[model samples]
Target: MVSKQFQFSCACGALLAAERRLAGRQGKCQGCGAVFEIPQPGVLSTAPRADAIAVQEVCGICQTAIAEDDPRTLCQACDLPYHAECWVENLGCAAYGCSQVNVLKVGPDIRIPSPASPLPGSRQPGFPQAGQSPLGASGYQGGALPSAVDRAAASPTLAWDYLWMGASAVGVFLSILSYGGPSAVTGLAALVAYAFQQDKSHWGPAATSLLLSAVGVVFGLRLSLLFWQAT
Candidate 1:
């Protein structure tokens, strides 16, 4: 015959069982590492009472039916039942206000929860907290740092830089036919494009545009001066 066991709970909400002979002895709670004196005989029951069995309780974490014969434990704080596996998977009691909500390892995995992981009901890595907007209070979405591609896409001056470059090219072509009048505008447009460009990769193209605009200005001015002197 199997010897009878006595069931007791720790202050941290861990359910513990010991042989009936070990009653009134000191025991340590595996959940929070708290040592406490075990209650004497008749203080706690080994199994759920008849009324509790008839109610068909569910696991607090998974919300599934817990069979009468299934391995389970109860949270000492809120008196909620949880499956043995569910308790280990969730790391502790799933009740919201229970003190053991963040308590680690009521089950076999005795290691503490990693600090990098967020506790239950807390904000996740990519999510916004309470009262925060979708883009977050800091204006970045998903709480992630802005990447190079993101900065490039959001740059307001990039469009203006390209527009100035295009204007510079058009002005240079006009200077070839209209003498020095268009060269002045072409040189100014090229200077603005070069100054506003932020990306280092485009520096070579900007320099080329500036040089070509300068040459156009000089050529047009020389041609205009020569023609005026001859006429």
Candidate 2:
């Protein structure tokens, strides 16, 4: 006697057999690793169900009815059956009004994610938390760059301390060679340039230039006096 059975399908076209009592329960497929819910048992009939028929149906593409043991393929979108060879020849689903082009390989489908899985748009694993910018830890607010970037942008005036220090070094070298007036004036002017920069944020280089220029001015005056006395 033929045993009563409930038949269902996976998204990958794998046919599944389930007991009548196991209906509405979740189970994994043997052919494919797909998790699916077992369909409720329908009324027993000698003839097959219109949609969920067994392998004993005629191929929609080739019109040849296949035996129960013959290999077959079924359309997941339309539940239409076709012989495996005919399905390959047709290149896709043969059901009317269905436009599916690729035959699905038996694998995972209709998956129900576990409860522990991270929700979409939530902070992903190893990613920064909310209110933190990817660019840096500071100089930004609400993910926007701070206005100080625009205020402290590259300026020609910032280069003054560097140029003044160079000019002061050249002045000191010239004063050591007894060229007094122009060398002393150059060192004094460099000191003034450094003074203006001291009130700004670049105090380190400004302070350095201030000390060097003061020493250069003193050296220039002493050298000029010794040269004048010798003449």
Candidate 3:
């Protein structure tokens, strides 16, 4: 779910055909540029994507180009393409402190070991295989981001999020009904307080902050007008 198809190459400057997924700590491709999906795992392809290059299906790990006639269902975390059997035999979840949950087969399998699923896409995001970026990056590329990265990016503060949402709503309500008084100021202050607690490092918090602050400002202006008229 968090995985994205990166249109860029690995941390190295090699040109890769398939999109790269973030894996490991470095956010680089699991195999980086050295490993690639192909007829063989250890074997490297002279041609990145042969003749306009179509991997048919990519390894979902490394950004390698599988050979036209190769047999493999998935690639290692490093992006080393492997046949289904090779994947089951060689690669599995390696996260520490997580048993039965971390190591398991993709989709479903008896040997890989995972909770059986009755429907497709039933698995949640942030799994080990998700969010694997290539070892590193520098320029622009197109591809879905890895699931892990998304989770790492998403900071869950349920209470804080709710608090801010409530404050913002109160601010809106005051602006509409009170026409500027304690209610208006209350909304303004609440909005600012809520914004400070929001997580915008990953998304565009700055923009939201500006927009919300502007609304508060307008409320304050209306309040000033009301008080001035009373004077």
Candidate 4:
């Protein structure tokens, strides 16, 4: 009697084939560790047999040419061969889009569970079970909290360009009362800081701050020059 074969594909591209009896059972993809159900032969649309394709002489993962005598494992799903070391290192089939684990055997009866065995369910690695939340089974109820970076970005204290512009204005007022030195110094400092930080600073407000600081320097210098001429 000819034995029947069932084949299916993992989303990652690994082709899987087993005895038809393994249909509807769960198995993990050896390549990507993805869990999936083995579909009944008819459930998946019929396609060309991946194993029917011929493999090249080069190892798929390492790209090194395989010597005819080099020990290798051919993926049953794709019929591609890799150096034994390459297959072990990659942990699965290395054909593009296929991540199924390397197989030593390719017969129908190799890995089947008895009908009495419970079928396994697939689950995401880090996700909690049904009805459970990260905080607790009851879920977080204290209101969603903002991240520290978000809070800092929203803080008034972070208005550095505004603060610098205010300082420049004060410096200009002081210069009019005294000399041009304060205004010139504050203006230059603000301009340099703005140049260095403009990319990361509030663009619109920083441009305004730079403009104000420049105007303050010009006015203070003009007043100081007139006062100097009188002296």
Local accuracy of candidate 3 as per-residue lDDT tens digits, 120-198: 2212221112122111111112232343235334432322233233344444444443453333443344444434432
* TM-score between candidate 3 and the true structure: 0.24
Per residue, candidate 2 scores C-alpha lDDT tens digits across 1-231 of: 555666767677866565554466445565555545556876644444546533234467765555567888877777666788877877778765786544544436757789655433222121111223212311112321233234224332333333444545555566554644435555445444434432434445445645655665577678778887888
Model number with the top lDDT: 1
Clashing pairs in 2: none
Candidates sorted on TM-score, descending? 4, 2, 1, 3
TM-score of each: 0.26, 0.27, 0.24, 0.29
Which ranges of candidate 4 are over 4 A from the true structure? 1-158, 177-179, 198-201, 228-231
Evaluated against the true structure, the overall lDDT of model 3 is 0.37
Instruction: List ranges where model 2 is wrong by over 4 Å.
Output: 1-158, 177-184, 194-199
Sorted by lDDT (best first), the order is 1, 4, 2, 3
Weakest 10 consecutive residues, lDDT, candidate 3?
131-140
- Residue 163 in model 1: shift from native, Å? 6.0
Cα deviation at 109, candidate 1, in Å, is: 40
Which scores better on TM-score, 2 or 3? 2
Error of model 3, residue 189, in angstroms: 2.8
Global fold similarity of model 1 (TM-score): 0.26
Q: Candidate 1: worst 10 consecutive residues by lDDT? A: 126-135
What TM-score number comes out for model 2? Answer: 0.27
